[model samples]
Target: MIDSHNHTSFSEDCKIPLNEMIESAISKGIKHYTITDHLDLDYQDKRFTFSLDHQARREAIFKAQAFYKPKINIYYGLECGVQPHIIKEAEAVIQKEQFDFVIASMHTTHKKDLYTQAFYHGLKPLEAYKAYINEFAWCCEVMNEFSVVGHLDIVKRYDLSLNEVNLEDVKDEICQLLKIIIEKGKGIEINTSGFNDIFQHAFPHPTILKWYKELGGSIITLGSDAHFPEKIAQHYEEALNQIESCGFENITVFKHMKPFEIPISDVRASLKLDIL
Candidate 1:
């Protein structure tokens, strides 16, 4: 199976060594995986400020490619926060690097915005949810270099109270953002990490996936978004089932900065065995 999003020690929040993570994934029969380390440039929370130094991280990624490829296909990538002020910097980094995949994410509402309780203080639950969606829409409109938009409904991870913000109520706005993402020819990731959290469902929600599919969205990637070795390939069976139910035939994988289409049926067959 292909795990399209992941992180390692290169990401400040995830301190696991790269070699160890890759070894665990290989043992799990995950033939393809991408290390999309965090690259949020202006997060306000110092505690969550675990991101790599751009240049050093890039060099390390490239250098490790030779070693990692022989064992399993390793693709270098970045999970960049798409805040308005940092768009230029994010774009420059993508253009300069030979990254196999770029995941545009909405981690912060703005350059100073952080996904903390303080940020949601005082606002009604629905209002706070709307604020996050509004920022996400704006990010999708402006960030064009990304190959896939990561974790469309990540704000729910922070505040489970916001999960009450039904997709139907915001369908028009969410669809507007999806339209821009489609126009830009970027895929949307079904981040499975949500299952590991309080929300207890994959990201973008089933209803949102149905909406995107109905809207003519074809490119979708599935990721465990694993931060630790144990989390690698976590809930992949469920993710694949979810994708198939959504009418998607294949999931996109990356190598040498290009996409490879893998049939969902083949992935299903592979999973039945103890070894990949």
Candidate 2:
């Protein structure tokens, strides 16, 4: 199976060593996946840059690929935390690093860390959710570099009870965002992180996936969004089932910054046979 988004020691919030993550993927029978560490440039927190030493990170990936070759295919990728003010800095990193995949995501809105409770302090639940969706749309409209937009509805991760919010309330903005992604040949990932949380849904939600497919957006990727060895490819079979239910017959994978496809039937069969 293909798990296109993941993390390791390269990301500040995660501490698993590079080789350990690779071993974990092998254990899960995930032959194809990306080591997409975080690169949240110009982050509000001064202490946590989420940036990596490009040369060192690349060397580690190369060594792992050589050691694990034929057994596993490790693709080097990056998860860029994008914001309005830091677009240029994000672009510079993309230009410098030749990643197999680039996942643009918004971890904060209005320079406020979404993970912190402070981000939702003043606004009502729906208002807070709307603000995040708006900020994500703005980034999608402006930023031109990236293979896919990661976790398009990540705000739901923090707000476990966002029942007050409705997709129709932000339908225009959401549709525009999806259009831009498809127009630019970019895709979206179905992050399985939420399955481990109380929310029990993919990051973008299955309804959102249906909307994207209805709008003719064909490129969809699957990721466990795993931050640790144990979490690697977590709940992936269910996530793929969710995607298939959304009318996607195939999932996109990346290599050398180019796109490829794998039939969902094969992936699903792998899950049923416990061969992946």
- Steric clash pairs (candidate 1): 12-50
lDDT of 1 by residue, 1-276 (tens): 678888988888787988888888888777777889988876767667645677877777667777777767778888887888888887887888868898888877744454666667777767777787788878778777788888898877777788887777878878888888888777899898988876656897878888889988888887888989998878777777788888899888866656678899877776776353
Candidate 2 Cα lDDT to native: 0.84
**Model 1 lDDT at residue 144:** 71
Reference-based lDDT, each prediction: 0.80, 0.84
Query: Per-prediction RMSD in angstroms?
Result: 1.9, 1.6
Point out where model 1 deviates above 4 Å.
Answer: 110-114
TM-score of 1: 0.93
Least accurate 10 contiguous residues by lDDT in model 1:
110-119
Instruction: After superposing candidate 2 on the true structure, give the runs of residues whose Cα lies further than 4 Å from its correct spot.
Output: 161-163
Q: After superposition, how far is residue 76 of candidate 1 from its true place, in Å?
A: 0.6
Per-residue lDDT of candidate 2, residues 1-276 (tens digit): 778889988889998898888888888878787989999988876667888888999999999999999998999999999999999888888878878999999888888887764577788877887787778878877887788999888876676556457778767767888888888888999888978877657878888888899989999888989888888778877788788888889988999889999999887776666652
